[model samples]
Target: MKRYQFNEITTMQYIFLISGTQIGIGILSLPAQLADIANTDGWIAIVIGWIISIIASTIIIKTMEKHQQDTIFDLSRRYFGRTFGTFIHIAFVAYALLASITVVFTAIHITQVWILPNTPNYLIMMLFMLPGFFITKNGVRILGRYAEVVFYLTLWMPILIAVPLQKGTILHMLPMLKEGWAPIIQAVKTTVLSFLGFELAFVFYPFLKEKKHAVKAMVIANSISALTFLLITITCFIFFSPDETPLLIWPTLSLLKTIEFPFIERFEVIFLSFYLFVMSTTGIPYIFTTVFGISQLIGKKDHTIVLLVAVCIFIFTSFLYNPSFFHVQTLGSWWEKYGLWGAYFFPIGLFIYTSIARWFQRGKKK
Candidate 1:
């Protein structure tokens, strides 16, 4: 029996939530990022990254399992004490906020460039964020439902990606390991950004309905995302020449441009339009987590106040300036670095610390 049933999400919801989070704005540019380092072998880096992400996500799940009913907020306080725990919470909130902002910027940038060049950035953001506000305010159940819906809604996306393969050169992807392991290993760091969303398992783990299946859920979620990345990456690698691939910014979207149908023209526009649903999965989770963290810090049960505050902050920040494409990419690069710290290093370090602490406590009791 769960103490708070409102927040408890089902196993499938858990899977979709994490999967949706991982497949965000990064997908549009991941093929380019990987191509920059590994050339045609970039798809290999995505595989390696997926394996690493699965391991990392499993570790996070194990750590949360120790304190089955407690959120990461409570776990940090338990491990680090009050003052330091508060500091850690603030840092996570910052990470989540920045991640959300990056998604917003990416969505706006793509929308402006591909769809509406003349629309005001702030106007786009306002329309963009409205659904997030309404969805996030309801609670994790609503968020989970939204993730599930979006997952199915976009399920056909990968199939459409294959349309570009008719023109793709399969030979470009041959000669595997042509650059040896160095570049592929180096490119693994870039793929880490694509795997960023899995870390949210920490916060969501306690809400899982089937606690024992947490690892299985994570594996499924991550594999779905990994396969999607692989298919898309491979498609891009095959579709573009080695030298030509890295030059294009949004290779995934560019591939969609090659898609021709009797009824539709400029297919990339339609893809980008529906992609807002995909992007929302990323934005909503981060924004929800940020506000949830803030509410936890203040010991508030109701998250509505923090949610309102977060919305105001997000909207106010959008007013500052419209960033150029380079600026958006720069911000994304920084967020990836920050995500490395918050998502991987921090969780792994904390898990080790918790394990040691528990071992010592048991030894003392003996």
Candidate 2:
């Protein structure tokens, strides 16, 4: 029963962690997804989505604050007692596992589609999952460092995306929200999936070095994600006709293909290579959070075994299933529905319950 040291991360690292996690494979198709629903005004949905994400993130922070230095597992136990709390904890672990699966599989699927069309899916999943386990096993500090590094390394992506706008038609974005509020609301629903990673804040909240700054970090992180989504979505809208936009999957990557350089051929190939770093930032954090949550629930001080178990399960499942493009999209759509519950609805529900419970306890004390 050896206890490992808990690694703490700075507020800034926390911000990068949340931002990097949220901006994953979903961003590749976000513009097209929104366009299908909201037309050119999809960026408006991003704004609305950001606001919703920020509010949800703040609630998560406040919830964690109520149980200082305790992970969600500990808080659940305190609120629900050991038996039911462990059940709740296990449920969250399951949710985190589903999230990690969605991320790694999506990344592997994208790699196969864009880079190595002939590469075996298992190989791609292993390549992504193995390195992630190595990083994740070290705990949150290492993860925070990896996220910060990925952010600096890929900062050039947005600028590269902007290059395509030179050929874009500004008029394409005109007649704003022609379809009005309904479509934008629908687009916001889709955008909520894109903002999925912030909810990981619950697991990582106790690891923040400056816990008081947790809300601020979450707000900044969600804002960065929102701004990034807004930029890429607007860039795509102005560049492609509304009808043309929804037809192209991975609209962001397609935009990269439009950029040509004298020395470089197939610019997207290079972009996708570096983008693996970005994708790992999303997957590894979820993997760590899931494994760590299970460790806490099971009273394990050493999480390495749990990590290995989780990775092995991921590999086994990914190896067994070879999803087609349409199947993968459908799978992701289903996960997004689940994500809304685990990320947004769960936190809000927990917060309200905790408040009512706390009020009852105070009345009893008086």
Candidate 3:
């Protein structure tokens, strides 16, 4: 048996890794989704969602800190019984797999719509998955560094396309909360799905070189991600009417399509090139988590086989839905909701259980 040692990644690199993973094609459709729920007041839901996400992320960080070097899987097994812990671990892996498939499906759908209309969906899916598998197989440290480099493309490209188009009316956002608090609260629930990847911090926590600073890094990464999503959501709502936003499949890209730079003929083309980089970063972590989860399950430390298995599963699942855009979107939405539950709710429950168990053990020791 070959043992592969895990390298510790820098706090800054981890920050970018977390941010890059969290911001994906989801950012593209979030305004439209929120609009569907809260109308023009959708941005309010985004703000509220961020507040909740921050609280959730803080709990995750604190829980990891209390356990120091233990992975969430180990902590779960220790806090809950082995049976319950194994169940939660399986749920985590399932959520990661579903999320990865959704990312691949969405990437293919976007490429088919915007860039490669003639390319077979499977071929495009292969192109995206292969590189991510190779990188993640190298290890999480490599993945974090690669994500750091890719983060620049992901962060700047959307802004480059969006910042120039600040020409729309802020009034479009007005008649605030017309549907009242009910819809705004529901929209906040929907918007929570967009903040899905913060919990990845739990999986990656053991690899941090500077464990003392991990919580700070996680906070910074999630804060930046929230601000970026908020800007994109607000920009889309301001530039396009609520009616126009939901009609278009990818509102962020649609907003870019309307921009014509002096030197650049089509801004959407520039946006697409950078968007691919973002997709790669976003998709790689899901692949890493899937591989990591399976490796832990089978007691294998060699990640190469795990990576290959993950790629095969992702490619196989991508084909399962017959490449229908609506089918992919619906499946993605369902998985996104499930991901929020697993990533946020399940882990928090484990944390509460762990705290109670520790308290009981202390009392018994006394």
Candidate 4:
């Protein structure tokens, strides 16, 4: 017989959590980025990038499978000595801290530009963090449930996107791979980075109620993210001319402007307003993972204290440092570089080390 943890999340919740993490603020700008590098062939890059992400996610799952009941933090301690283990935990702490802050700044910048031009960033941040603290403090189950709900709540978006496509020209994307395969390959980095949320499996794997579904869950999560990006990226390619696509900073959000209804005049604004639910799914996971990792590092059963301190520190930091749009952009650039290494390169290294280490152990036992 198997015993389940008191606050375990189901396989579906696990899928939603990772997908929600991957489908954040990046999607708004990804089409424009791909357009810059690959021109009309950028959508192809998304598919390639999706394949790479699936492989990386599978590697992470395989690494964690050796320690089914332990998170990355605990695995680090077991795989490496105490000193090196603590270093990896600290690295994760820093990554999650910066990642969460970057998400806050990115969302704040978008909200101010689209809706509230007059509100202070700190005030907006306070509003965001309050609910964030409440949700994360409850535990992973709440975070998982929130993600699942947000996933369903935002399903109407594809139908809404279809409204703009009514006027889109399919000719812009007709000559696919116009410049050959080089541009698509180059643009794969951007697409892979957009799929960054899958790394959270390092923390989420242990909380999964059913261990057998880990790889399957990752495949589902990455597929949903890739398909959604394909929809958005392809929509942009068909909607805008090749020359015009690269010039836009947020082709996905800009696409929303074309939506029309009897009651709504500016559709993008309404769309972004509801998009907060989607954004929270990203932010809260980082928040929970950061606090949860810290609690485990310090040997605490409850993460509430660390969560409280982290929230207070961020709220206070917001008061002092109000990043400009350019600042946020620069921050995101740095985060992407770090994410590429953290989520991709590091996982492969860990998997190699794990395999060798276990091999040596088995040889010694025999």
Better of 1 and 3 by lDDT: 1
Residues 21-114 of candidate 4 have per-residue lDDT tens digits of 9999999999999999999889888888888999999999999998788788888889998999999988987788778888988998899999
In Å, residue 52's CA in model 2 sits off its true spot by 0.8
Residue 311: error of model 1 in Å?
1.2
Models 1 onward score TM values of: 0.97, 0.96, 0.93, 0.98
Model 3, range 60-171, lDDT digits (tens) per residue? 8888887667777777787777898888788788888888878878888888888888987778878887788778878888988998888764656655656645788888
Off by over 4 Å in 3: 1-6, 316-321
Give the Å shift of residue 120 in candidate 2.
Answer: 1.4
Whose lDDT is higher: candidate 2's or candidate 3's?
2
> Where does model 1 exceed 4 Å of error?
none
Cα lDDT, model 1, residue 207: 84
How many backbone clashes does every candidate have? 0, 0, 0, 0
Evaluate candidate 4 by giving its C-alpha RMSD to the native, one decimal: 1.4
- The alpha-carbon root-mean-square deviation between model 3 and the true structure, to one decimal in Å, is 2.6
Model 1: lDDT to the true structure: 0.90
Which lDDT tens digits does candidate 2 get at residues 60-89?
Answer: 988889776777888899999989998989
